[model samples]
Target: MDIDDEVVIIGAGICGLATALALHRKGINNVVMERSETLRNTTGAAIGIRQNGWRALDQLGVAETLRRTAILIHRDRTVSLDDGKVHEILMKGEFRCLRRKDLIDTLYDELPSTTVKFGCQLESIKLDPNTSKPVLRFSDGSAILAKVLIGCDGGKSIVADFLNVKPTKKFSFCAVRGLSNYPNGHSFDHDFVRITKDNKFLGIIPIDDHSEDEKKEAVMDVDDEVVIIGAGICGLATALALHKKGIKSVVMERSESLRNTTGSAIGIRQNGWRALDQLGVAETLRHTAIAIQRERIVSLADGKVEEIPMKGETRCLRRKDLIDTLYDALPPATVKFGCQLESIKLDQITTKPVLRFIDGSSIIAKVVIGCDGGKSIVADFLNLKPTKMFSICGVRGLSNYRDGHSFAHEFLRIRKDNKLVGRLPIDEHLVYWFCAHPYVPGDERNWEDPEEIRRSTLDLLSDYPKEIQEMIEITDVKTLSFSHLRYRAPWDLLMGTFCKGTVTIAGDAMHVMGPFLGQGGSAGLEDAIVLARNLAQMGSIHVESRRKVTVQGVEEAFNLYVKQRKMRVIRLSLQTYLTGMLLGASSHLKKLLCIVLLFLLFRNPSGHIDYDCGCL
Candidate 1:
């Protein structure tokens, strides 16, 4: 077959249709091919247009055209069927809800009918070196030549197969969605409303209804018990806790796959052990992790070594293993990958938070735990930002597979000229190490590259002991990590209690001191256990009063949790920050002062280490 079109779109789904429409407006002729019979086949589905989506549509010059026929959604509602509790939230930014067919029809009407060829399924593709164009063979004994073949076809795309591009598969949660016909008027004030019952949700949006058809609304039957915003350590831990309590929560991770900030290991301290024990993973971790009763510190200037018996309870566990253990406890389908949080709106009635994903999906949780991270968007919901205020920066990573480290599992620290290198054995095959340096004005954003970081760290610790230097040279570049390691002071927590309505932050999102004391990961576990306890308590509460009273109880519990964590986190955060200062001490006087302070602090360990939130 001979084709004249310069561009051929492989699919006529939303992406293909939109691209074709944009090309049409640009006076660039393009053909859209669809295997589907008709656009109206998408009749029952309603698509949400968030602020970002609206902006993209505006650039495509279709925003006004679509908005004229779309329903503006500003208010959202969630009702718990367990009791008759209803929660209302005020939505922000521009939101529109319209039927999928209506959107397709509008985009289709913008183009000439012949622009899209229906029933033309793509069979195979051949790329020609001369034109560098794609030669497409269709299932209907027809062929087309395209200057540019854009595969907008979803997963299982034939074009993708031709290019040998594997489609990324994600576990999709089950949803039963269809049009709920209301021949009579369905009375509702808000444009968007979602009603949820035991493990099932019914989301309905009033139709834009340009036609005289009697159908009044669209219904989305989504079966989900909870929506967790982040898939990091705390997010996974909280999911496990909820799982143990018979409460199912789906973790929403922005990344296509798991990102191990815990690339290698975490210091599971006494507090971490307590929280893990409550979650029932303590024994497993203990078997895997090395108990750290003391740390060996070496001074390169004098070639002297001293061992310090650490007071705070500490254990070094592989970062990946800890996260995997927590994540494994829950059902596999409970986490949704590639679902990044775009924005969050507060539900005024229940004070619960409404989460909006980058994909335009909105979720209302009975409670939303913000375990996103140090630069948490959920933390921003509290009107704060992570201040990059630490004077010391560190690069950390685990060595590639080896037979095993020869020594015991105790931590090793070597210091010279304000630069320090610390190593802890992660397993027989892998050892975790961190290289630290004093903050230099020029050292901004240099840690982005693994090789560059490794080299720079080598330069910083040039005069260190031979074995420590060999560790840096021989370590695999893939496992290395460098970060500013931020922390929040009291001012960042704000004047009001940390818990606002149904939103609360945990892990590095709430407090981010350096890993000097190795308590960063441990502190996060504490947050997870405490928050889960409060939320589970709310779930267990018998609703004698359904509406306002339930809100009060939830809010009171959140406040108490914040109050309980305040003193504990503040003390640890300060100590961890101080430890960073001690690690970077260069002058003789400063070193002496650090040694004395550390000795005293080690002798009189704070009661914080022994404290435990009574087991769930």
Candidate 2:
């Protein structure tokens, strides 16, 4: 089957099918290779195709089929279980939920059989250097060369690997859904209700095919809610995600007030951008956020600054802004600021845990999520030990860019001796910087006091550039923070387990490592979305059915979450550690060579961007 000159598409999922349809509409023929004998039905679950997707379908002349076959959800209802408050939202444009199979079938029927090849899996991919075209090799030992190659093979894509852009796959959450035949209209006819619970989120929609006369019965004797520990970014994001799905959760922060002193700024790459955009949290922060353009690495030994080609939708924003952005998104009562965790007791029979707060109040939780920091109690409860420490420590600070500043909207990195320092401009008036260096064996006072942290920071950065030293001096003396850089080995997460029973961990609780790649916060944000999605699917029963959410359901979700996320986090942990080592090289000549090699290898930072998190 060796062929030449055609648009070759791998995988027949939504993206592939849509691309095929779009191309066909323009009178362009394409060859689609599907690994399976039949089209995938998105695991037999109903999924919502928003207005933008509907518009794409319209362009392909299949919008009518979709509208007729799917349920038209004109209105959406969100319920808060904590306060029992109902908020009605008017959806604009075409919003519908349909069986994934039905949508796939509609698109497939429009295409000619000659255009699609089933049971043809991609084994390897190559590009012709002379012709500059993509060459594909299939599992059946056949080959084809295409003018253009589109890899829509989902997470584990061979074509993506060929392009050197294969994503590190992870499932931070789980989703279990079922389709119900409702012959008659119920209370939620023509409407979609998103209900929040204690342990899970239930998204119930009324399908168009209702029976003429159906008796309405009460549904839900099931315990579906969650108990969230640690009201930090991860916890708040998780709470908001659950709330959006109309799931109930009690967010308990250990401190009496919102936690502060977050150590300056943080970076959110394309992955974080897409997640925040999908979660409806990115729009407002755009004004205050700085779009990072290039990464400037400085050789402190000779003061040679090299600018690497770094681009894409990378953003640097204040830590306070990120915390406030996530924290304020939730309803006022969603987070109980002063609710500290004193004791956790799990019932052996039900697997439900009773949480005792320091104030003497207690709540029994069916599912508990630990979003606490590196020293996570939930991790200990689940038998996940603290990450083994590396011989490095990290110090970070934020400075007031009171007037006009020199380094705004850039990610500047400096390497001197065995120390690595970075300055990222978060906004016009603020800058965030961090130093990762060899840890001192005996001196531990810097970990406690901010003044000592400043002194230790100065000692480490003895003869840095003037701007770098001045930024450290201008930092708020109270806000300087230090921590031991520790990481769970890749195998530790791959084989060492993350959850037990209904108790699990999210974000830093599950994978705590050094912040070398600046993806810890982004991953945490993504965790909120993934974990909420999986928990929501566990409660996707028909409104008229009496199916109690079980502990087994929660465990199934946790299993999928761990399985999906383990490898991705492990890859990120190793990349971050290796990057820290390269940048913290003690030998000047070795550092110069590594920087040159790194610039050549990772110059296009776009390849390192986080884009795959939103699809799940």
Local distance difference test, each candidate:
0.72, 0.75
lDDT of 2 at 9: 88
Model 2 over residues 16-105: C-alpha lDDT tens digits? Answer: 988888888888878889986456654656778789988878888988988888777878888989789999988777788987777887
Residues 509-593 of candidate 1: C-alpha lDDT, one tens digit per residue: 7887777777777777887777667766754453343211134555776787788788777777766656776766667787677
Model 1 residue 501 CA deviation in Å: 0.9
Worst 10 residues of 1 by lDDT: 214-223
Highest lDDT model number: 2
* TM accuracy, model 2: 0.59
Model 2: residues with Cα > 4 Å off, grouped in runs: 1-224, 302-304, 342-345, 358-361, 444-446, 540-550, 582-606
Best-performing candidate as measured by TM-score: 1
